[model samples]
Target: MRRGRVLGALLPLLLLATGCGIRSTDVVEVGDPATVEVAPGAQQGTVLYFISSSSPGGLLPVVRQVDDPSATSSSGTGDDGRSRGKQLALLFMGPSRAERKGGLRSELPMSSDQVSVTTGQEGIRVRLASGVNQLSELARQQLICTVAYERGQGTTVTVLGTDGSIGPARCSV
Candidate 1:
């Protein structure tokens, strides 16, 4: 009778231990995830990617306060949500004095004037006034990474090089 009582007492506990706490039902739909929407009129910080030894891809992001493009330009009317050319201009400015001292660098291999970056319904495009093919792979990665960060979504950038050749670059990392 004692062994029967002990076995009966332990059986329920063992059953509970073997079962998951969530024994109720099928997969639950929690609806969509929340998203952060930036107000168009607000001053937004632009993200620029510079080369850094400590970063995962050697591309480090530095945020600088910029006048909100959506608030300032007609191009902002579209869903693209950013001023690509303007951000590229900022990227061309490279890392700030403090950033450089901290070991951030750039391998863009072109001046701001040498490249024209634009975005539209078709997507972000970069036209090189000079050499695009001549750019080293690292330099290309720097450009690709900056544009991807600026554009969001890690999308590809189509380059219109001076050689009348156009190609697309996507971030491998």
Candidate 2:
């Protein structure tokens, strides 16, 4: 009888100390995805064009961040040509310090202020002070890829010179 009383008392003490049969509940609320607003031009990253070290003179597209808001174009809407113009300006500026360290370089002429890009119904139209036909194959590829990426991939693009149409190319990458 004494042993039975001790055993029963010990069981209750164990349950009380262990918090047995107690339940915990927590509730959290999350924001709605549909209501989120993202501005295209105000984005934090840059889509820069560079020459590839591995491909033996191929264009390498690098999407990295920039501190300056003016470093890239806000051309996602395809309504304004100024966005494309901004992107072209960045292209002509050449590779960043980090990119040069990584073996990237720009083939496009740094002094070509006459190069301008505009969006149209068909695709992007690039006006070059220099003849489009004069551009090296790799240089042309750099222009095509950079403009295409900003305008939209797979979009058709044409190069024009003061003389006339240079050629038509697509942004395949």
Scored by TM-score, the top model is 1
Candidate 2 displacement at residue 26 in angstroms: 43
- lDDT (10s digit) by residue, model 2, range 1-173: 99999999899999988889797668666776565322243366657667887755477777656676444656355445565666677788888798889888887888546666766677778887765566777777788887776555677889887667745787544
Model 1 Cα lDDT, one tens digit per residue, 33-66: 9987432322456666678899777676666666
RMSD of 1: 4.7
Show where candidate 1 strays beyond 4 Å. 1-14, 17-23, 34-43, 67-76, 79-83, 110-114, 120-122, 163-166
Q: RMSD for all candidates, in order, please.
A: 4.7, 9.4
Best by lDDT: 2
Candidate 2: residue 79 Cα off by (Å): 3.2
**Candidate 1 clash total?**
0
What's each prediction's clash count? 0, 0
